[model samples]
Target chain A: MLATMLYGPGDIRCEEVSEAKILHPTDAIIKLSASCICGSDLWPYRGANEVTAPMAMGHEYCGIVVEVGSAVKTVKPGQFVVGSFCLSDNTCPHCRFGFQSSCEQREFMTGAQAPYARVPLADGSLVATAELPSDDLIPSLLAVSDVLGTGWYAADAAGVTEGSTAVVVGDGAVGLMGVLAAKQMGAARIIAMSRHKSRQDLALEFGATDIVSERGEAGIARVKELTNGVGAESVLECVGMEESMSQAINCARPGGKIGFVGVPHGVTFDGQQLFFQQKSLLGGPAPVRRYLPYLMDLVLDREINPGKVFDLELPLADVAEGYRAMDERRAIKTLLRF
Target chain B: MLATMLYGPGDIRCEEVSEAKILHPTDAIIKLSASCICGSDLWPYRGANEVTAPMAMGHEYCGIVVEVGSAVKTVKPGQFVVGSFCLSDNTCPHCRFGFQSSCEQREFMTGAQAPYARVPLADGSLVATAELPSDDLIPSLLAVSDVLGTGWYAADAAGVTEGSTAVVVGDGAVGLMGVLAAKQMGAARIIAMSRHKSRQDLALEFGATDIVSERGEAGIARVKELTNGVGAESVLECVGMEESMSQAINCARPGGKIGFVGVPHGVTFDGQQLFFQQKSLLGGPAPVRRYLPYLMDLVLDREINPGKVFDLELPLADVAEGYRAMDERRAIKTLLRF
Candidate 1:
């Protein structure tokens, strides 16, 4: 099997790796159909997050199951499936309560940008479609594994609903998906903070009502202006930087809700502002598994086209180029076909 | 009129101040029936919070309407009323959405430890009871004005429901009231964290299932131990200190909710832990006005006794003593009777 491996910052390689086998009775082997680079993956590639030794990369994928352990009952071989970044048991107290990301037996998926991979907790993690999706729809279905599901989680956590005025921070793939999620959920207005022309177009296509190119205080001022000097009812903080976090908080109305799904970096919040300003903040690794069914349906039914985020696509052997394209901002996301 | 005024840190005096009168068409002059010192007041009294010059004290009280501006129609002379620390125009979007403390036209209440108070936004801030209550109920009714109301907001914000395991971080008057609020809301197990025997007794009396005297890490560990290593379902952070805030977040089970009503001081959260831990945190000033009506019914029907928090009572002339008692820890709360 060939998989993408991260040796160090700026060093990505696609080479032959050990064959995938059933690690446990609950594990299943997946023949990767499509996998993509994520903004979060950039953290380790840029050396911001510590990466010791070479490790398998890619935590997002949609694939067909080639083999399954005896213990895997729900998901079976020969099924097209999508799974969350977090492999959950789905029966733990946390999973039962709808927080699969924090499942008691949760495991992070890696080495997914490969020809084959082992998926543990198959019964709980993998969701099978009625049939294999068309090749054109594979990219969108693949996004449901992480980015799209994360965006949906952000909107759900922010309490975005019909008539809700939503503010989306960051113009990355996840941020664009957040716009789509808010739109699908019936948000009356979605103000996307985007500066890039390409992302701005995608944001608008994803259903952004307005776009604010400004950053920092000016960005917040623009959102406030759009919200009648109050601010958005629900704010999605899709970027994890401190500046992005602060902007999201400031962009919400007093007593408004903020849903943050970014993998925070150097982010710290003033407790006084959160308490006195009455901006409710909720964030973390998204519970994407909980929303997979709903989002998969949306993707399969063509209600949403998240695959547009994959502006660059390459063969699995060119995985190194995929990382570079995203790292250099040459692509919003790069999908690797196996 | 005589009022409690703060000249600086550790300097308080009962002195004659400007007379209270209806200052605006929406204002009502109330003859204060009862007033109390709050934990927040101690911040300024102890020099923790700056007090630049002599300022009127006492932001919590229940009083009798003595006069009203022509615009004040709902509240008239002779009616007893309770008001939150924040005077809101209940008609604002935030207030209409049930967040009166964050009302756009909100004003902080001050100078209530005097013989009279000028209640602004009278129609929205003042909740008139059916009639004058008996002497014994006066203290409890006064609690409804702030402490009890604040505690109730904490529980409500934390999403407490039947069978919830509630952990209160503070053991002060508000924390005790939170225990009572949890009880009234049908929480299955209420855990009050306190080191003081007096407060522990009050907590047990208020329906606490267990008392964890440990503070900080030990306190969080104790809570986890009691909840089958899962932590509590709902955590009420009644104290605004960093240690208490962190404890509350750590004490909540994964995906659990935290309602913090404490005025945060020098508290900053580690964004990474909050992001990956999947804990939902929301805090700010309590929207006490929204709960006033429902709570008033509970107090009037003798369903709750929040006034038990008043451990010391002094005449209005001995206002300085009232502040001293709470400052010296000789009382959990001090009531200044006018």
Candidate 2:
């Protein structure tokens, strides 16, 4: 099987790798139909994260179950399924509380950007639809496995509601999908902060009521002006950086909530300022498994078409091109078809 | 009227000052029955926070209404009342949403250390019992105005619940009250991080299951060891320093919540670490106005005896002695009688 491997920073290659099989009683072997490059992947690619060794890449994927272990009762061969970035034993206390990402028996289920991948805790981690999804829905379902689910978590964390005025910081695929999530959650006003023209346009199409081209202080001012000087009721921080986190805090009204989905790089809390302001920060690695089922339904129902984030596509053998496109900012997200 | 004022760091004086009166249409003048020194006052006394001018001090008090402006409807002359440190117009959107401290039309109502103080937005700011409280309840009602309310906010923000374990990071009046709050909120276990014998005793009486005398990493380790190596489910940070804040974060479970009511001095957020940990942070100045009503009811019923926090007492003319007691660590909190 051909799989993507990270040898070092900015060094991605598609090479022959051992095929995956059911290694555990709860495992399921998936023949991936679609997978994509993630915004988080760029972290290591840009040398922001240290990659010590050649590691199996990719975590976002949707596929058909090729094989299933005897203990995997819910998932079976020939079924179309979507799985979370992280695997979880659904029966754990944390998983029962809807924090599957922090499941006690959690496992990092990767190697999705390959022809086949092994999924652990299959019964609790994989969700299957009634029928095989059409080719057009594949990419959207693929997104549900990670990005779309994460976007939903961001909106939920931000407390986006029917009449909430929300600000989304970042213009990556997850940020763009956050606009859609907020819209779906009934937010009346969705402001997407983006300087990239392509991402900004997508944000508008995804139900962003307004777009702020500025960053930092100026962007916060524009958000306040858009919100009639009260700032947004909820802010979804999709970019995890000091500047972006500060901007999110500045753009929220006192007592408002900031839902951060971005993997934070360097951020600090000013206890006094936060105390006086009354703002709340909530979010971390999203529990994608918690939203996979519902997001798959949304994809199937055509309620949201997050697949549009895939501006470039390639065969599994050309996975390196997908990474290159995203790295060069030539693609919002790159889809790889098996 | 005699009042306490801060001339500079470690320079507190109790002397005759201008009498307070109804300054706004919605204001009411209250002749204080009791006032208390707060833990936060130590910030300036210790020279941690710069004190600029000789400003009237004290933010916690309970009193009898002496006079009311034409617009004061809910509170009338001769009524006994307890109000928050922040004066807020209840009619504003922020106030309506329960964030009264950030109300659009707000006034900083201070000078509670004096015999008389002005209460802003009296109609919405003051909560009264059926009858004027007996002397026994005066101290308890005084607690309702600030420390008790703040403690409740910290517990609420931390998401303390039945069977949940909590870690309290301060040993002041508010921190002791936080133990009470967590216990009332059904926290099964509470670890009070304190080195003070008096506070530790008070925490035990308030339902703390354990006490940790260590600070920072060692304290966090103690909390984790006590919680089966998973850390507490909720962390109440009542101290505003960076070290205390970091300790709170380190003492919580991966998916736990940190409710910090401390006035943050300097704190930084490491995005990558926070994102990976899945912890949530919430809190600020505290919506004391939001909690005053319920807390007042508890005080009326004698369900909580928060007044025990005051270990020293003085007349308004000798309010400076009360400050000295607290500044010298001779008292957990000090009360002033009119």
lDDT of 2 by residue, B28-77 (tens): 89889888888888788778888777878888878889999998778888
Candidate 2, pairs of clashing residues: A264-B271, A264-B272, A267-B269, A268-B268, A268-B269, A271-B264, A272-B264, A275-B284, A275-B285
Summarize candidate 1's per-residue lDDT along A225-315 as a digit string, tens digits.
Answer: 8887878889999989999998999998877889999989998888887788787777878888999999899888898899998899899
Best by DockQ: 1
* Per-chain TM-score of candidate 1, chain B: 0.98
Off by over 4 Å in 1: none
| RMSD to the hidden true structure, all candidates | 1.7, 2.8
| Interface RMSD of the candidates, in order | 1.2, 2.1
TM-scores of chain A across the candidates, in order, are 0.98, 0.98
Query: TM-score for all predictions?
Result: 0.96, 0.92
Residue B194's C-alpha lDDT in candidate 2? 96
lDDT string, candidate 1, B1-338, tens digits: 78889999888899988899878999988988888888899899888888888888888878889999988878889999999888998988789888899999989999988889998999999999988888788889889888998999889888899988999999989999999999999999999999999999999999999999999888888998998888888999998998889899999988888999888888988899888777777777788899999988898999898988988988988877877888888899998887
Give DockQ for candidates 1 onward, in order: 0.77, 0.57
Chain B TM-scores, listed for every candidate in order, come to 0.98, 0.97
Tens digit per residue, CA lDDT, model 2, A126-199: 99989998988998999888888888899998889998899999999999989999999999999999999999
